[model samples]
Target: MAFRKFSFLSLVAGGVAQTGLAPKKFNSLPLGAIRPAGWLSDQLNVQMNGLAGHQHEIHLDVSQVNNTDWTGGSGYYSNLEEAGSYWFNAAVPAGILSNNAVFNNLTLNFLNYVIDHQDSTGWLGPEVGTTKPRYLWGRYPFFFGAIQLVEHDPTLADRVVPALHKFVQVANTMLHNNGEGVDDWAATRWEDFVMALQWLYDFHPNGNEALLIDTMKMLKATGDPWEQVFATANFPTKAVDNTPNPFPVLTWHGVNMAEGLKALPSTFRFTHNQSDLARASEGWDNLFKFHGRPSGIFAADEYLAGLEAHRGTELCLVVETMFSGSFLYQVAGDPKYADRVRSFSSVAHSQPLTPRHMWTRQYLQQQNQIAAKNMTPNPFPNDGPYSNVFGLEPNYRWPKFITNSFVVTPDNKSLVQVYLGPFSTSTTLAGNNAVTVTVDTQYPFSDTVKTTVKAAQAFTYLVRIPSWVVGGTIAVNGAKATAVAPSNGLHAVNIAAGTTSLVLNLPAPITTESRPHGAIAIHRGPLNYAFDIPRTQKILARNAAEPRAVDLEFDSSGTWQFAIDPSTLKFVPRTVSALPSPVFDQAKPPFSMTVTACPISWSVAGDTFAAVPPTSPRCTGANTTLTLWPYGATKLRISEFPVMHA
Candidate 1:
């Protein structure tokens, strides 16, 4: 009952039909279609110095002859393929957009590696061994990476499309030979490969895509049915000891759950099954009900850790969830899913990005020292696909964060703005006329957004009014227009033939939200406010044998045991002439808020401060005027706090 398998065809024939679904529906924009402007552009440029840009530097080191994870090593496996997969998909594309020559060269080198090395038997990745079976996990990223590569350079399509054909044939054979038991990593994650297949089938329908899609689905259908996993809520919601052995199964793992959120929905895209949509929504509800945090992420150190504020979420899961949410929104075309993107972008993913950047600088210096020592297997866990790789890959969760979220309407007539970051989109209208729209604002810090649209002709622009903004208003060319209502999240305004300004005002007010155990978190719109506790860092060696292998630990500098006086919360904005070096930098935050708070007694278990704040902490210290920073700004913060006596 736990490991039953169901075919994609069986699901469709068993009631779900392909009728009424469009023969061709493109839900996502190309890799570089939407360009970043203002601070968002600056953030992309800053990433090159870290892991995102320098993958070529560590690629050879991590996959060389002596490394245990790659060819010629004792294991004779391709552990680095997953990391290489992301490098080509994200790091390379970002480098090309930023015009970083070194990164572009690195990316080309990786693409050339695949193009130059297709074996006579049509095998692509690292050399497969006789005794050990090749893992189907890394192939998913490589397939998607190839698709993106061709989008950037069509000449590569000649190489990429054939390579995928070879991979599909070989992998399909392996699936049948194995008699149904799927690899643990590959079982829950095959939806990503199915999605890639759908993308390929959309582009090259005449090619082997039709057969390839069915073959891949046949491969996945033999694995775990994710639809049932979520529909029945089969896994444990609490943190448990599965260490000495990996979680006997995969369903309960937080990262997999977060990444798999779009699985059933994506399947629904092809099957057009309404039940898949209902199940996807129910899965999300279950996650939040059991382990959701105010940080806009479900707690998972490595697994679902329940709704304890101090219980941390992985940086990887945060990024994956954002990607999943964005994909789900695009496929479902629902604004509610888009709102989930706003929360994670403004709070969860944004916070980890800055700290990952700081850690990356230290990581690069250590990598150089480690290389000089000639260590095997790189000993550095935070490289490539691992979130801790302390590189730009982890720092900037999605290179297409804004582009993927803001997609063209199905009719190719209008643009839908799902995210708040500053970006510009240029598209061809109905009559082959080109249109470009530029959005300018310091959103999450300020509620006002000004959009300048220059078009060949007049068209309807649909701007999404975020759910948090209740009393929103829209003005055309600086004049207040009552046509745009605040109640509906979607606001459509028509622009003249030439240049026109569409001003949107979403005033955010201070609000408090209750936590699990009598604690509360403050919010102004999408941004969550936290008590900025002063703290110092200590660098510790992750592995004693390798001095260069390190991670940072934070200790309370002054005192973090304080509760907010909910009545004295005052908001203040600091005028910044330019954006910070890294947009989420704590040292130079864009805004500040003053609050009156008193110290209380709180205990710390290992590294994290207590999740549940003291139920009735005595106000022993003086009521001092303390400064609270945005959730994304501070590293050591007490965002959920107990209420103090006036």
Candidate 2:
């Protein structure tokens, strides 16, 4: 198949010809277009009831209460980066998706404050004057959040768009002036800045196309050479060491690599270079081949940790990787990228990155983690001793926000790009017909999906068939089911006006993956099964003044040293009246699996972290049926186990 290039204008309504711009395969809908339903709604509520909803009131230092950088105060930049920007980013989607009025109002107030306080010289954040050095890295996230807000609530667009234009003008001037204000962090992850620029150009250029294009070009030139790095031998294939080398900062940094994954693809949009797109794909494959964990994220506590299951993968890296995967799926239209987005959203989010409540988060999560405590000589190369402990702002904090799983097809149809939990969306299709799509299913937990479409006129509804699915079927209104022969991984069904029903069943079977050190990981559908170990939580700080801001440590109370017999694995379905409040809670998993296993001598490194699984270790104790929960449900778990032969 010949590689195709698209124009950004081609996807928009009545878009004008814009030369030298690469086209996107898909474009995301506004914030409230898709709203959470079923267990997905419950997950968002859990976050709102936890830290995300109340961070400003509790985490005084980092939250917007004191960090008035974007609100015109001269607060520290780190505070905005760590908490303020991330809080707004998560809160906006959570608010719009869940329809929480308070969260919506809170986000709107912040937006108004920032927009109202824009500096006269087009500066957006706390770095206001030319007398001191200004860092442009912090403003990128704040603008990302601002862009989302304007997308969802366009009432602010008239104001927000103008503010953004002014800021970009100043940014272009700064970049052209010997790349002033472009620091190492901003230079390494300039793709995010380019993404914001591209969104503006695609949607609201308002006759400023030249300025947006020149700014993107300058940013790309100032940024790291991600295309060459990924395309050539410069990419790191091994665990990065602390000792300095000739490698650029993007090669070893985990978050940068995750964010940088979109650099070449975003660059391809403007450059229209197929090699740039191809190299982006190459970089993604290489990153996971050398550093991927069973939980669907690459290892990089701070740097590129290798494939050792014991190495910690940062929570920030997981979120950024998901975002990058989403971008890749949208621009490249690859089923593999969508498949990864689904896997990472289901498995990595369920892992011990954060508790069910979403109150506290880990700096680094380990696949072989058995204890969540402060460690002496921590296993993470670039993290502190307390990296694994869950706290309000463990090392640095960034809340996990929901990414758009649906895309607006160029033909004005809505496409389910990534299959997630139950959700519904209302949008206009071709012929100016209004349509509402309601997907009802416990997906990633169950293989069956039931979609109900209510439309004023007939239209085609598209859903992606994951790469793992084979011989899937789609039935319309209980009629004879047809085999789903996907073209480019999408199964499209024609629907009549008024109301229509769709039942899609993608068979999910138990599968095993061979891991590092001769260990094995189990998967059924999108969920990865792990050995759930019992643990006792200890509050690291019991400050009466700040009860909710205290840190927590978890110690394993049950035996975690086990090698599984994969042949004995059996899927066990549990009947529940309703899924629990915290969907990822260990006590209320909707379903689980039972497998015969025996105790083994899996030693510990650093006196706390579990060592690498022994290669084909012999079971020392009698075989027993052990219940395995979803990877996300367990706080202390062994996801990758040594294979014990029967």
Candidate 3:
């Protein structure tokens, strides 16, 4: 397995040693509870499967020169190798340990490579003598892997611990060897080693805690710049050399390293310092304030879209954000993290590499609906099928990071996360050792959900019934069961079904919300809406507001009425078509909108004006009852309907 190029199958053809180590207990914030365990598992499986053949296989390139030559120190091939190993350690022994064979096979091969190569210093990873560079290298994989495998197999632990010792030696030597203090980006940094060592202390030979703290303190003294974000902005950087446009990118490495910083203390039992916490806070605040999209994802469009329309983001940033979101949720315990995770899962993670799982695009997404940076521009581009650099590039399966791991609350309770089709999750009944219950549901597209419970002993099961669940009746066997929506959001139920069945009514459907210009929009859940304007017609987008000037209003008659503020709406005369026999013509550059919906409404809520979307719209442009629905649905009709207030 070459370090720079990522491939699915393990590069190591041989096998690894067998070892059993103590498992590190997982303590993710309630972030992932918002998703069905099944859905999350399925996605993780896809990633793992892509990475299955690659345990012994590794991508160890390290020369950071990304120009046409691909030369020089080539950054660090070892960094990627460490990352691959980390993935195996953290992900393999997780909820879906069924996939252990994938990494087991890889570990078997890895042990073959590192076992005999250790010197007295005990370092097994790459370095030039005692002099090591100061940058992030993902070395914790070995320690984590050893810890996870220790209890189950001791032979593996014996073989791996020596390698960890060598790592500690080299790391200790690197900070002091150059005789200069913790200052700049060498091959590795104090924070980088701290993360790995922290994990090693928890899982490996119970590493040197005092030394680990000293190593970490180096980063504090070194100082931090723009502490609010993890990635350094290489705006207008050339995309991995293959793509045409030089994309603006916020590399995932920086934030990921900080995340690594976040990961370390838990294992070390070090109370997080206020400065590091401040750095993380300001970093995220700035990141979201600048690059955050409405979808809760930060921009990584490669060229860092400047005034010119030609920058791009990376596939890496998407996966990295998932990790960040997981951490933030742990700190804040807010539902927004779940919302962000759900949004990413529903949008960014769902798209396949080659429309199938067979291939993948190196840079996974684009901010502009029609990625125009590397355009074949004889014809203009708009909202059509977006594209990425799709092929069998390194990772088609268990990605090194991002979109790969599963989340769970510290205590096992199903958060009524995603309403999906036919899903099931099992956990021990609350406070009972012998009882286990698995709830299954077929939801969203359908109304009725069936849940079944099984246990050897009697216990209570608390299932969250979503607020969206309306007029629901619970039943056991064939009789009615009691259910309650305690507080505003959660639904509580007590069940002692050793092996029982449950049926619930999920009568949730789309709800309505009003938008700008007295226009009404339909909403199903958290999604906003846009009219599925047909390609044959042209419409405008208006975005402006006048202080104290109420120009649009909604009436009890179900129509949004507005007075024209010539400044608010303008038009860009371009026509587009919807689905075509051959193909859908891409959406055109948006037009300038002409009307504003900033008036008052006379709904039961009284005289205040709400920014509602018009539910009806068409060519007569001047006075139309523009119809609107939530952004999630739109097979037809106008979304931004206009109205006239007499």
True-vs-predicted CA distance for residue 177, candidate 1, Å: 3.8
TM-score of each: 0.86, 0.92, 0.55
Model 3 TM-score on a 0 to 1 scale: 0.55
Q: Give the winner by lDDT: 1 or 3.
A: 1
The lDDT values for all models are 0.63, 0.76, 0.37
Q: After superposition on all CA atoms, what RMSD does each candidate show versus the true structure?
A: 6.2, 4.9, 15.2
lDDT of 1 by residue, 1-646 (tens): 1343464555563565564233322266676667887877777765665544543434343323223223342211244346656555666568756867766665566666665666665666665433455677676776776787677677787777777777677767766665332578777777887778777676754467557656655655756566776764464555533433223356666678887897887677566667777788878777876777665667765667666664446666776788887887777666677776677664543433435353242111110010111123332222322222222223445575766746767777776677876888887766775788888987765677888999888877777777777677788897865545632466777777889888887877788878766888787777777765576666543434333324554445777778778899998887776667676767556777788888887765433335357776789888888887777666557778888844
User: How displaced is residue 422 in candidate 3, in Å?
Assistant: 6.6
Candidate 3 lDDT tens digits, 1-646: 0111212121111222212221222333111122233333444554444422332233233112112232222223244344544444544343224345645544444444444545565555444243664333445455544544553456766666666766666656654444233333322223444445555564554546656544444332332322322333422222222334221122233334324334322212333333434445444545554444433354443322211112233445555456555545444333344345434432334223221232233343332222211223211122121224332224422221221122233454332222223344433423553433344532332345576666655544444344444565667666865554533233444555457676766454444333334544333333333333332211111112212111111112233333222223323222333211111112211221223443432221113222333333322344332233222222122333333343
Candidate 3 lDDT for residue 596: 48
How does candidate 1 fare on TM-score?
Answer: 0.86
**For model 2, what is the C-alpha lDDT against the true structure?**
0.76
Task: Compare the candidates by lDDT and give the number of the best one.
Answer: 2
What's the lDDT for residue 396 in model 1?
A: 42
Q: List candidate 2 stretches off by more than 4 Å.
A: 1-20, 63-83, 242-245, 351-356, 394-403
Superior by lDDT: candidate 2 or candidate 3 = 2
**Deviation in angstroms for 431 in model 1?**
3.4
